[model samples]
Target: MYSLLFYLALRDAWNLGAIDPTSGTATLLEVTRVLGDMYSKGFRPRRSLMFCSWGAEEYGLVGSIEYVQEYVKVLGARVVSYLNLDVAVSGNYTIRSTASPLLVDAIIEASKMVPSAYDSPEQTVYDKWKKVRWNNVTNEPIIGNGLGSGSDYLGFDQLAGSSNFDASYTFNPADHGNLGSYPLYHTSYEVFSMVKKFVDPEFQAHRALGQFTGVLALILCETPVLPFNVNRYTSALRQTIDSFKTNDSTMFDLLRSATNDFGIAAEEFVARSKSMDVKNPYVIRAYNDQLLQLERAFLNPLGQGGAYSDMK
Candidate 1:
């Protein structure tokens, strides 16, 4: 999936003659091609698979938002997990995975099965020098911030209530700078050879990513236990309510009431979840159904108004 997205983004960028800073049309086209290929290959079974190549992602994930609004019910019923990989290939070996605790544990366990890959000693020396220079000038740590819809993961996460993960590696700070670590990014130079050399030398990082993703897919396909953590959901709700309270007290009250109700529901779910036997099909179905409903209860109908409004 990462490779397909990468190729599509790159190809679209090339066809456009230059990057469309506003709409990212070229990027979206590439994504569409990838989805089309997957469909042609019969990758989706009886299950409903959504292949989204969101447009105007650079303008803040508009394409994805529109999609979610149009198909909330279908997404709610089937989207057990949403995995996002954006800018998957980079010059570093650091793998970062972001998700809820249940999903995070699954990713960690899967990543461990893949061997660690690192930059060469010479590359490390250059990275150290660049980091020092940036810190000396900005007085800020050079950390790659968590994922936002600089890619397509935003709508799925914030709107659909789907369990999601975004994974990437950090290598050269140069990649993020105006200088040309990724010289071809938004330019004509983002060709296959350039990616092979500067972006993912030795391909070990790419291989590790494949292994990690494959393991994750296998787990999602096979696991009888639908890993949902109510404690985390409650904490997140509290934080969201606190953040929004300064704007409207009525909204705050509504959120608080909802939070309390959700807490009660969560407790019920936890009890039921803990008691379920992994080997029982009926127990698994019941647990998964409840988990799905618990997520749906938090949906705000007037918020995003997508098919998966339960997520909002």
Candidate 2:
């Protein structure tokens, strides 16, 4: 049940159903087209792939949040990944993505395979994104923007703690004042004409975005080990415990000890994943059952419904 929760539906404020251009016609439509192409090519997926186009995303994440609440049991049990796409290429900035640590490596790998539409076909998406953000001294690619509670991903990640990824190409670091953007955010003025004239005149980024997302989806679908690196998360947890120490040393000791246990468990899982017989469906099922529960390990006890659910 690793879902494709496309929040590109539900454009803002048009009373009856009409064309609302500010939403993700640019991104989601391209993905839909690509899926059709895949189907035509006789491509098949090993595991379940669910596609959901959510509605009423403007006032709140009404559609997606409710869907998760309704199917919490089945989704929580079966969902291993949730790839979300919304407002993917509305501005001039390069690729901006946020990933759970597990999918971070997969996203970087997928970007390298997708040819950049802005540059020549030889240059990859990762090449363009890394060139500006790359640190020459450290020799590491710069990190991407973080995901917040603003989009449909919040519903899945907060409610079920689903491992998730999301992104949008929008304003530069200096353009947070909202200038030099697509300028068609949530208003009736967000017509296609404005998008055509001002923002993404060539629509090249949107095309590249489709390929990038498609490649990532293929990797998740076809990979033997699910592309998850539990060690990445273990490292993250240890770093977090290092910062902002609690007043209670006992609680600190407990947290540190839990991270150690988690590290051991992750190593065992990764070893099992690597050594498992990929030809055996039962073996794959056994491996996935373990991997699917990784998301639940992050859930905090939010108890009853008060206001917001816990996102860990």
* Number of colliding residue pairs in each model: 5, 0
lDDT (0-100) at residue 59 of candidate 1?
Answer: 55
Model 2 C-alpha lDDT per residue in residues 1-312, reported as the tens digit of each score: 244333353344443222242335556667777776887999767655666677777768788878888877666666767777666666655777777777777888998998766577798878877765575754645554335686777767766666788766554656567465444455566666665665567877677777777778778877866777778788767766877657876778888898999999989888767778989877877777677678677666572266644322
Error of model 1, residue 232, in angstroms: 3.2
lDDT of 1 by residue, 1-312 (tens): 110111111112333323222122332344445546766997653223333444565555566667766775566666776655555555553654556433644664565455555644343322432433234543522322224555565655556656666655435464466343334555655555665666566666555555555556556645666556666577666755676636556757876897898778778878767677878877777777666555555456555545443543
Model 1: residues >4 Å from true position, as ranges? Answer: 1-11, 14-67, 119-148, 172-184, 235-268, 305-312
| Model 2 worst lDDT window (10 residues) | 14-23
Off by over 4 Å in 2: 1-10, 13-23, 135-140, 143-146, 175-184, 242-253, 301-312
Report the number of backbone clashes for model 2. 0
